[model samples]
Target: MACQDSDTARLIDVELDESVGRGTPDVEHERAVAIFDLVEENSFRPVGDSGEGPYKLKLSLVEARLVFAISRENGEAVVTHILSLTPFRRIVKDYFLICESYYDAIRSATPSQIEAIDMGRRGLHNEGSQTLMDRLKDKIDVDFDTARRLFTLVCVLHWRG
Candidate 1:
């Protein structure tokens, strides 16, 4: 039998173009989990004649846009889509601020305070993810969870880029 299984349109691996840089352990952990969760379970399919997937993706910030560079399992380039980061800017900023609050709350604030901040963080995250999905509507297909995870990765990229 062939070593590779049947080709399916999904993400198998992912990479970030730049290091997030110094003193952000929490951000680094978020990046790691985003990649792990995405590879473990995601629905990714590029539109048009991109060929079969089971893809390896590299996400990067180029200028003001976020780039999705997709390749096949064999390392053949499949498609590249650059999405404008404009729509996500405000929400991402809000998410970061809420996350900071949530983290600080965990260390010293009451459980209720932590929960409230967490809820706000989750709301902003979902909004950011949805905006991403809308922006990529014609270029790629991604489920809410995949978009959510990808949004986290994007936030990290934006944080450093």
Candidate 2:
């Protein structure tokens, strides 16, 4: 979907907490790409009269809770939402497992095998995205694709290695 100039309900900047250590180069690459894609096209609007147009977001994990710190394009403070990560733990674990399998399969497994693992990976990803959307329903309004990309960043923050 094309973003209109009048559509001030999109995100222009997204930042992850520095405390969340970056893992491998692959993980870093994934983080970078997710940020780029999210900034390029996203629909994020804080529910209520928080602020206006083209917001900035900071995602972090604090005391096992996921924090979403939002601000205006000019750095003005907006609403901050802290969500429990309990809903995501199992799905994130499953996603990581499927991702590991997909990575290994890409090395020597047949194309069909790789595809099968990838399918599972996408399924878990979708589940996580839906969960995220549901959790944020009361605090923020985001499209499905935007939720998917945001969910990717959420997974990145959960990376322990």
**Quick one: best lDDT, which candidate?**
2
lDDT, candidate 2, 1-161, per-residue tens: 22344379899999888766668887788888889998998888888744577899988778879889999989988889999999999999999999989989999999999998999999999999999999998788888899999999888776655
Residue-by-residue lDDT tens digits, candidate 1, 1-161: 11122348688999877733433776677678878987988788887744777889988777787788889889999889888888888998888788878878899998888888888888999999888888888788777887888887778765642
Cα displacement (Å) at residue 125, model 2? 0.4
What are the clashing pairs of model 2?
A: none
What's model 2's lDDT at 34?
86
| Candidate 1 stretches greater than 4 Å from native | 1-7, 18-29
Clashes of each: 0, 0
| Candidate 2, residue 82: lDDT | 95
At residue 121, candidate 2 shows an lDDT of 95
The C-alpha TM-scores of every prediction are: 0.84, 0.89
